[model samples]
Target: MRINQPQLIDSTLREGEQTPSVAFTDQDKHKIIQGLCRIGVDEIELGIASPLNTYLPNLVKEAKKITAGSCRLSLWCRCKAEDIAFAATCFPDLLALSIPVSDPHIQERLGKDRDWISKTLTASLQQAWAAGIPAVSVGMEDASRADTDFLVATAKIAQQHGATRIRLADTVGICSPARMTRLVQTMKEAVSLPVAVHCHNDFGMATANSIAALEAGADSLDATVLGLGERAGNCRLEEVIGYLALVLGEQRYHPEFLPELCQLVAESAGRDIAENHPLVGSAIFTCESGLHQHGLTVNPDMYEPYAPERVGGTRRLRFGEKTGARAIQLQLHKAGLRLDEMQIKDLVHRIRSGGQVLNQEQLLRFAAKCC
Candidate 1:
């Protein structure tokens, strides 16, 4: 299952910060950057270079010092001179200039035509290059919605203007995996530079689309911790890296750090992680169903796709109304307790009648009192 190691461009700060009411302080930024570096991500987009805030420069400096060149830092900007100029002052390893490619976004948002977009993008890239930025990544906003020919042409123009990479942004997350694969493949065939993908989660397919892009020939992928972004969110950092490891057999990232990183990002964003969040969720590794518990007891792999430890998690069997006698026995044995058949049967009956899930402490107390 070995495959090419696609570079991970974690956009937690740039995109995740865009989540409603989410803001990261200097300390929060540093912690996130440090964790991303420790996990060996290829790059991190710090934030947009506009607004010229007093804290942004200091944040970029602190991030640089923290990373110490272990991971690359990139800055996002609009297709405007001022944005690029200000981003250049941050001294990021790469500057990502965004341009609207779709007709709707172009005509509605910018009130410009396709020709205008191309010219503006060309000028922006030239400006960024003239500023002597280390590198430039062109962000094709609404790329998935744009016409394929126009998208490819835009990428070509960007390359002509010295863009080091072309980021295909699924701005609305309306792309399916099949569409993603086709678009990425077409872009790869048309462009010479690396093609990266930034997917949103409006359709709950950002992760699938990103992986599809990778399989189609993309060089890098963008993600945010917990998929925190505008609307539904973006591709989840933990989910993408974990999928690469457990399914695709790529192991460059340190999955063990995801739990801590997830907590850090969630705390910074002031958001609660759902119990069903794929990688760092509290209930992802918790088993409750009788069939699942039985399979897990026999062999974890029989029921679980991968071990919980693979993503810095632990497995726990929940005793609930669905608890079978064998599952209760397994739980009791795991808790280092022994019970006769009658006691076990009685306990199963009580659990089934309780009509709710019981935690380890409650189960332990029950077992001790009954058996």
Candidate 2:
């Protein structure tokens, strides 16, 4: 498939806030927005601006003062006149109005039908346009579950009402890569405006689906720092960006700032960065397996895809239960020690059983013991 350079729309401030017990202070917002700009993301979705939170107004005002055009800032709100009016007051670079498009959501959630959904979307778009909003987009909530024909119709309504873009949300994370690609291709054919994909990780496919969507002509994709959001959270910014850079040869984003960005988000969100999380995780670049470590000692590229420094991380050779004799010998050499094969074999045996790696001081004691 032909690769498309898709724009990343980070929703760390919007959907990310929906994570349980997570709220960003004004300072948190500034740090995250600044980091996103530093990493060169195309846009950032600020939190919903409707219902007028006590802090949101002040947050938006502060964001305007601090952002200074590093990236476009947009606000997300429901498809209602009141929400759009409140969102307009924030004066963001763009406005995104979310509307549910599935039959279940239309009939059960809102007690409305497809016609009502279309009209509500049209009316909301009209109101935003008349209010002189800079740019408007429609977010199709649960688009994966919506009927394909009805989904196209919804996109048409948004396009008719002056939407510059439309987002297809896999609200439940049920779509596969193939399904995501097909959906994006269909939407691209059906609509003239740019199509964006927003995926959830209920089935652990958010990142894969997002990549598939972009490969199939999606113009944009949504991600949150460390994948923070409701339930299993949204697509992870680090994973998607890493894949694009290391595998797909896309370089629109600055991956070097990922470690710092993840740390910032983790601090504010009260979330721990998993040691095994890709890219920014602590142990992603560390090797402990005997065979892998042996191969790594021979050549760093023997097992590594790209350098750890590429993402502002360091490569480490861990000496642990799974470590091999070569790894142990290497560590010993690094500590300025040498031993015969027999002595090294005895030490390796003890290490495998229970011997801990010695520091320089402990190594001196060990050398005296051997003597």
Candidate 3:
């Protein structure tokens, strides 16, 4: 069954900050929070709560004031008493306690066994609840590599411990969509709490995996603007939301705010938006291929998946080395100029030889000379 309305927990402030050399100042964080609120995200992960990160408490306070309960605010914490204590001070609506369930992380990184993880997780949850935190989500770090039975057992523990949600993380970005589908399905079947998925893009399938999870009845998905995170980043907020709104007819998200939201995050992250980046890219709507251009002129739906305006973009047809006669004639006619078959063919040849893309006005100017 398709999840018509999946909750989006935007992690731009949390996971996005993990990107190397990226930091959001107080003002930047507030602006981004407001931007995310305007886009109607169900929740916003403010950032991690740590003693060394001294600004989190005040940031969460200000974010709460800015959002005023319109959106739920969450904080990421390790499955440690200290982290849970620090997170409680922030007074976020939810605390996401990240625990490594994979053997490599549990046995090698922490040098502990499954018993230690359960003890640590149980203690952390008890600590958060004792501090009067409203909700908690158990994030299973590296769950993609964890044994399915162990994952289910861990999820059961989380549910028993009063976690409001269970988040499965593809920590290494290695989970395929098919595997992701089965994993989410299994987790959902095993637990009564809401299931969320967090995917990385190391293998470039984060968005696909997220979609598969949603298809398998995931209640929520995590994403960051521009997919900014460690080592290739997380699932992109724009790509997932775009797919939901445009493909599955999920209407809770507003695609129009994506361009501005992504631009804001990009600027703050000191990164440039790729021209061909999906959904929010500046040049995605610009087409130059002869066949595509001709098809667009004939019927835009033939080549375009959806209208450019759907995502606050404009469509542009440009002529270059691949320009065809029919496309050239159509563009010329639209400009109130009629070029015969021979003239159109000659113009196409000149455009092809020049090897530069020409807009409608430039093509008109070239056509005047050719005729």
As for TM-score, the candidate ahead, 1 or 2, is 1
Candidate 1: Cα lDDT at 254: 83
User: Model 1: how far is 1 from its true place, Å?
Assistant: 5.7
Candidate 3: residue pairs that collide: none
Off by over 4 Å in 2: 330-338, 355-371
* Candidate 1 ranges with C-alpha deviation above 4 Å: 330-344, 355-371
Per-residue lDDT value at 197 in model 3: 97
Q: Give the lDDT of residue 196 in candidate 2.
A: 95
Over 28-98, each residue of candidate 2 has an lDDT whose tens digit, in order, gives 88899888887878898888877765566667667766777767888888987878888777788889889
As for TM-score, the candidate ahead, 1 or 3, is 3
**What do the candidate models score in CA lDDT, each in turn?**
0.88, 0.86, 0.90
Residue-wise C-alpha lDDT for candidate 3, range 1-371, written one tens digit per residue: 46757999999998999999999888899999999988889999988888878899999889989999998999998987777888887888999999999999999999999989888889888999999999999999999999888889999999998999999999999999999999999998999999999999999999999989999999999999999999989999999888888888778788888999999999998999999999889999998888888889889999888899988999988889877888888888888998777777778889999968898888888889887
The Cα RMSD in angstroms, rounded to one decimal, for candidate 1 relative to the true structure is 2.1
Q: After superposition, how far is residue 309 of candidate 2 from its true place, in Å?
A: 1.6
For model 1, residues 179-295, the per-residue Cα lDDT tens digits are 999988998899899999999999999999999899888999999999999999999999988888777777677888888999999988888999988888988999788889988
Separately for all candidates shown, the number of backbone clashes (residues 3 or more apart, or on different chains) is 0, 0, 0
| Candidate topping lDDT | 3
RMSD of each: 2.1, 2.4, 1.3
TM-score of each: 0.93, 0.92, 0.97
